[model samples]
Target: MNTYQTLLVSTLFSSALLFSATSHAIELPQLQQRWAEIKYQQTGKQQESAYQALLTEASAARAEHANDANYLIWEGIIRSTYAGAVGGLSALSEVKAARKLFEQAIELDANALDGSAYTSLGSLYYQVPGWPVGFGSDKKAREYLLKGLAVNPNGIDANYFYGDFLLQQKDYQAAIAAFEKALAAPDRPGREQADLGRRQEIMQALSLAQQKAK
Candidate 1:
């Protein structure tokens, strides 16, 4: 081929590769697995270098698969993980970014995963301190949580957060019911063993709520 024709072909090939990389869909299960590992590392107070590397890789995957709402959701979740690892101003920034990304994902696909975005947003609102003050907002928290439950009654995060909110509100019976629902949720993401462990924890929480009710 002529020199100019070869150069043109090379450019086209490079462009194609770039497009393919950017348009690829991130694997949701793999992202969740990595996130769980990050969480474990944080809990153990171990070096998080590997977790950081995993986040970088996951971020790249999400960027490549920008069209996938789940990819966006995972990206937001990883950002929240990074926030927890690095406390202070950086953590706040990361969480804020995470919230925005999650909101975007919901806007893009509200009905995805039976309204996972609602669950995520509900948790964020419930957990995050209030603006111009602290993060405790039982009323607003309950509002979002209830909204999420309306979308998906069996949603894990929604049930868990709402249960906590109810406990805080001194509505022990409601708290117990919420936690029991969380434990019974069938589609939680994570390793099988880890999922079972979480269910057990939720059950324990339910028991506590039951005691409080009595």
Candidate 2:
């Protein structure tokens, strides 16, 4: 794989910090629950295969709940993660599909799943290649991530990703602040494993940002 694909694939499977939501409000709670398990519980080839299966399941869920922002966002999340898992030229198509799904979710409801669409899109914009290659754009990433924060300023995923973007931009202090906020975000009631994993990621980001600041 090329540089963009390599980085994109490795970083794609970062699960979202999901919170308990009203049953009717969430179109696919089962998918969300299964997703957290597959992302944080599974490992290596097993994890990758699970993600691949989950992507298919997510696609079916989307077909059933067409136009539902929740389903759209979840499916997009799965697509992105699966792309990261597979990591090849073929994965490129999956990410592209994921990007469109996120955009569609935003158009339907920017606040669905705690503004996850914006956050996912921001992550994708930064991960994908820019022009002449893919559609990655640091500028767009910052804009979308900030929009995600505007919708859910204290959201764990939003802050963590924003911090990641800042770190990439060499703003170590700002990245630290963002990671600190992410660490302070609330835990998911039914998603303890995902919370644990995300906390580990936040802590690692914190350590790196602190080191870079010194």
Candidate 3:
């Protein structure tokens, strides 16, 4: 090979090695932050390239910290987001992968972050469509969600998702109660506007559910 070609190959190899080393050194929190940033970008616009880059980084972080429950959960969440962006079969595969990751997290630490993994899995199971081979387990969904709520009665995600599930089941009163609990949760991590906006949306949904129940 020419000198230039030889130099290029060597540089590529060095870059790969450096990336491998750096990925191993990355922490779970950093990965989670990146995932969150990517999610924010996704909300603003359909920036596939940015999302892909974040997912690539997240995958590397996940590989380096395979035993961490938080990493596993974020990895699953990122995959699910990617799948949602690319719908159809790809989305289904992503959701399935996410479900497995959440399950793994639960297995490792069922009580982590007040049973966030259980709440996630519950919502996924409930929201995912019933199918011949993938997802759609209402029974499993309810079981996990209740488990989450049992662990932390005021868990935002658990209450919100369970409320949605109740609405689907036509248990309007139960749904309203759950929604109210979610809205009333104190000191949640988000800003006031975000939190209040979410509460407002839930209240609207609850109102609709109440009317339907009547």
State the weakest 10-residue window (summed lDDT) of model 2. 15-24
Can you rank all candidates by lDDT, best first?
A: 2, 3, 1
Over 1-214, each residue of candidate 3 has an lDDT whose tens digit, in order, gives 9999999999999999998777564566665555555554355345556667767777777787878887778777777767666667657877888999999999898887688788888888887788785678999989999998998898666788899999988889899899989978875553444455557668888888879878
Clashing pairs in 3: none
Which stretches in model 2 have alpha-carbon errors above 4 Å?
1-27
lDDT of each: 0.72, 0.87, 0.78
Q: In candidate 3, where is summed lDDT lowest over 10 consecutive residues? A: 189-198
Tens digits of per-residue lDDT, candidate 2, 1-214, equal 9999987776664322132221224238678788888877787899888888877777877887887898999899988988877776778898899999999999999999889999999999998878877888999999999999999999899999999999999999999999999999998777677788889999999999999999
Q: What is the TM-score of each candidate against the true structure?
A: 0.75, 0.84, 0.77
* Model with the higher TM-score, candidate 2 or 3: 2
The regions of model 3 sitting more than 4 angstroms off are 1-50, 189-201
RMSD of each: 4.2, 14.8, 4.5
- lDDT by residue for model 1 over 38-80, one digit each (tens)? 6653453353565567677778787877877887787887776
